[model samples]
Target: MKSSILLLAAAATLSAQIDRIEGERIRPHVKFLSSDLLEGRGVGARGGQLAAEYIAAQFAAAGLKPGGENGTYFQRVPLRSVEVEPGGALTATAGGKSISFKWLDDFVATSHTQEPTGQFDAEAVFVGHGIVAPEYQWDDYKGVDVKGKVVVLFTNEPPSTDANFFKGKALTYYGRWTYKYEEAARQGAVAAIIIHTTPTASYGWQVLRANGRAQPQVRRAAGEPALTLAAWVTTDAGAQLLGLAGRTVEEMLQASDKRGFKAMPLGKIHVAGKFNFKLQDIETVNVAGVVPGSDPKLSSEAVLYSAHWDHLGIGQPVNGDPIYNGAIDNATGCGLLIEMARAWSSMEPKPLRSGWFVAVAAEESGLLGSRYFADHPMLPAAQIAANLNFDSFSPYGRVKDAIMTGADRTSFFALVQSVAERHRLSIKPDGHPESGGYYRSDHYSFARVGIPAFSINMGGEYEGRPSDYAAQKAKEEGSTYHQPSDEYKASWDFSGMEQFARFGLALGIEIGNLEKIPPRVDAK
Candidate 1:
């Protein structure tokens, strides 16, 4: 009975500390970060450097110690930017007839091997989804030797209803476009071409076009297996190429969906490409700060909070707006990180473990900053207790539920549920698992390295709004996401973002005070 009373008192005190976090405090940060002057916070750009400096200033004001290298708040991440020059050609030939594809209109490609000038002429082979999963007993490259061939494949994996097979309807990492390219390189393929379809890629062809034209920043260490050409073609172009060999896109799609699918080489069909690339080496920094714990021994272990501070910098104009401000996409998340750092710094008797805040860079460039941190950590991987990530937050009003994707995959789920119950916020499951929400954000980088991590956000169920409010907001977001129209508005309600930060604070406190670190249930 005495212990129960003490626990109640501690909970009340902790609640009071988190109550200090407010929407008014978070408003100014979001407005400034998403302002036009920031220039979309492009990675390795001047605006990106300014964003990192602003975050470091906020961390200094909160009285937190620097958690980065050399007694400073900056950890440098090295990258190489690859830009494919125009005037390149991709052609498919069969039976003495050839069809040349237009550069950006019909196809886009680059050589990941870092070659300044390269060309490949090889027979085309359809390698079904390009996946090789031993657990599911699946291997698309089973019988055929695809070495020195141009491998053509789809983006996602085969459909499944059983959870044991490729995680059922939820898309696994194996289904990502990155995985497709990496697997092709591993199989000794000279080049890879992905057929873009709305249902498979989860976005329209416009998204691919935008990403393809942009300079891609990559982290390739020495001696990595890479392809001479990684390419994507529209459904129309794919059908045209396949038709040359007497096959339809519909027929190939149906055959690939079944198990034991074999690699089919197109008879007498040859794909060839010639390209020139401009490469530049660049550096970006991850801003990191820490609040030391009160307990001496336990302070060695740490709890991490992360947010990515990047977006699609300057890009093709939409509605005469060329700046991708990324207001709700990530400015809200960084705003919450600043406020949470302030709150954690002011705790009277600090939690048992240290708390670290990191605003990563190059998230829009494929989670590069977070991946670098995971590879080169401040503390040993085993000493880090857990990671609580904040990505894009809703600007709508408060929500009655929260979505903590991938939390159920760790032992922290019980504590997460209890914290949600305390705040009158119900725990909600992922609504669009097929989009692979778990693998899309910065948290996945840590999770990939055996660290327990998950992103925090308000669920679709809002308070004091119409029943269809969530659906309406989702529809509105689809049009603005990654578009220049994603700008900040003073009229937005930041109460939902505030609520998410407070919940994160409470959950982080619980994890920090635990007797032992939470184990990752899915750890191999």
Candidate 2:
């Protein structure tokens, strides 16, 4: 009877502490992280290192244990930067005519390996969308041999424009360019090149170039087999090459839109490039802090709250502003992570499940740091109950509902719904599966290995704003996203951010106190 009374008192105290975590209280952290001094928090840059240290300091101040390497607050993730200098000499021959393409103009290629000045000399074959999903009964390589040859692929999966195709307007993992490259490697192709179109790729050629680099991957000595080269060619360049294969670009695309498409051989094709890449090992960190649980058995289970702190770093100047400060893109998410941790730590008696507050690195480069932790976690994979990720939170205003990016794939909606209702908010279904939000964040790394994961955001039904406020915010955000113009402003609001954080804290507490968590929902 005495123990029961103590438990109730502890719960009450914790509830009061959590209520102290308000949006206005988090303003200082947000302003500092998004400040110009951080230099956009670019991974591998000094600013990135500073950001990691700042997170570590916050963790220490919050009374959380250092959940990192050697009893410290940093998980050192070794990454190699491969800058592929575009002096490439590319040539393709078809219809008895040879065409020389302009480097970085018609296309851009990136390398992740340690090889310098890589060369590609092989036959080129055209494969539709370059996806092979057995579950879907779709195979682009049906009756084709691409081993030791260059395989040409198209971006996106046969256009998931409707529910009839790969989730309909929602992008499956097979639709991403990364998946296209992985599939080519699985097919034993020496080289993989994607044919890019503005509409198909959902961005312009400039978007491709602006984001082109030998995306930093964890420096792995041995892992999955990879293609020798991964390249992208513009639609015009693709048309030139496809024309030589005795098929018009339209004919090939039309054929691609349907299923059971066989690979088309580009007659006597040859692509030559001497890619100059500067490979160097760069060390980064994933800042983690842990709050131990109250119960021994359930304490072994940990629930993760993740947010990426890295952004595009310093890039080409827009309107003479070169730094991509990533104010809303991710800095806000990191601020949320820290403030949430502080509230959790203030509880008199901790919840049953341990809580992991992870601020990962190199998210903009590719979800590398998260992938590293998901593979080599502080605790075993079985101990991680679920993951809730936050990235690019909208600071527009409060909403009547909250969003779950991949809610349909998980049983977690019950808990989220129950908690949201207390705040007079409804649970909103993922409205843009077309954005592939499920496959793009830190939570994905956890979900890939079967840990139930999902991301949260404010729903579009804004209160005290115009009916079209959501649409307006989307349009404005999409316009300046990833550009130098993504700087923070004094006029921006964080009331919605604060309310969302409170909701997330409540959800975390519920999960931490659960006796049996929801079943693991596999994204596949």
Candidate 3:
């Protein structure tokens, strides 16, 4: 009798949420967003502006109220684009000998000072991995004072097979280059340089050279600590830098893996650099809209659903294609967000708490828009029930499972599991956790601020394909991810996206109606 009642309840809930979501309704949005005319939806570009306006219009059509600043559906995000100008130089001096490395060939760097030109000369300190995790009982900076020095470090943390140590091979935020720079600044370092290798960074030298040479960042707030220069040097450059101190990069790597390794200063080695910067100030927008709650007492509390709408604008062409049309990278996620907003707004009696749909900008530029929103939120961080993010989705038809990375780290796990089961979708573990995906997405911006957040994506288990289909699809997806070839196909499947959208909508409503907000579940 209990089993029968549970089945009936699940069916009822499914019927209510599925009433408004149409798989076909998502295609038009994806089609237009990924069109060549949008120029890849580049942040701070004219194409990015069009994308924001379209998202706001979709929200207005869905009966959502303006949830941005001053009764508008757009939240302004100020940004600065920085690129190293030509004729700049980086040199390492040791024992009356100086070695000057060529830009983009040996190293790449940009200034965070927002100044047109600057120079710094300081002694070099090698801090292995540059990580300081109290939980892991590891401190590379122990007994070392690196203030006003140039801290050179590797890209990844120590190797570990035990899950208790650094999450066991799965990269943590501490392993990310962004964290390395942040920690360096906090330690009063004038500049931070990461030694990059394809194995440690999970990418090739070309990727580092492409991104490090130019980048965009959120305008720094006053009083925030920052390094004057952030850089990445090739493995060869790193070897030469360390060789000047009579050490090998191989020896340093081996020592960095051991526990209790301490930082060391390079003997008589110093770095000096003066780089001119081409700086431009640009403004972007994060389109946000809200559906008010039905319950008066709970209406103040809120839940946020987010998907980034930015991609690499224009870059060097691959096979003569310059546009990085991010169809699957995020256009699909934005389409799902729009359709979900319409469905949530159509409910007769809305959830107890308000539902916010935010199509953030500049995610491809290191989650700048989402970071800005998290720092300057429309609602209090404490009152936020949860944040559910959508990034990339497979366009290869329906699947038997869904992947919700980091959901297990929150109190919403039980509800998420129940909803997936009710919707006949299995939950899958992260396939490539070593990639540090959790720290790479916009959801991490919210998670870092004490809010429960995770991204929703479809798993590889296609419902009706041959056994080897998953592997084949994985290879195919990798080739198109972040490429111009990721253009939208009218024949592409939206069934899986539509199914997960329903599941997300139902789960969010359940959370909103709960007696208390969801909280983070500390890892054991």
Using lDDT as the measure, the top candidate is: 1
How far does residue 79 in candidate 1 sit from its true spot (Å)? 0.5
Q: Encode model 2's per-residue lDDT on 1-524: one tens digit a residue.
A: 99999989866775686686888766677777877898888788888888889989999999999999999999999988777775667778755788787766787776644566677778888888898888778999888999888888787877655675687777888888889888888888878888888667776786666565546766756756677678898888988877777766678777887866888887777766566777778989999999999998999999899999898777656678877788887988898899999988877678889999999998877698999999989888888888888887677768888877765576787787887897779887677666677788888888888887888878888898888898987786666667767767777788888888888888888888888987776676
Predictions: Cα RMSD each: 1.7, 3.0, 2.9
Off by over 4 Å in 1: 1-5, 214-216, 476-478
Backbone clash pairs in model 1 (N, Cα, C under 3 Å; residues 3+ apart or in different chains), count: 0
Give the alpha carbon lDDT tens digit for every residue of 1-524 in model 1.
99999989997899899998998899999999999999998887788898999999999999999989999999998988777887788999999989998876788777788868779999999998999999999999999999999999888889988999998998999999989999999999999999988888888777766565455466676789889889999999999999998998888888888899999898889999888888878898999999998889999988999999988778667778878898987999999999999999999889999999999988887899999999899888787889999998888889999989888887898999999998889998888787788888999999989898999878888998888998897787676777777888888999888898999999999999998875567732
Model 1 sits at a Cα RMSD from the real structure of 1.7
Worst 10 residues of 3 by lDDT: 206-215
Q: Model 3: how far is 230 from its true place, Å?
A: 0.8
Which regions of candidate 2 deviate over 4 angstroms? 1-15, 96-98, 159-165, 220-224, 244-249, 474-478
Question: In model 2, what is the error at residue 471, expressed in angstroms?
Answer: 2.1
Q: List the residue pairs that clash in candidate 2.
A: 160-169, 162-168, 163-168
**Estimated TM-score for each candidate:** 0.96, 0.92, 0.91
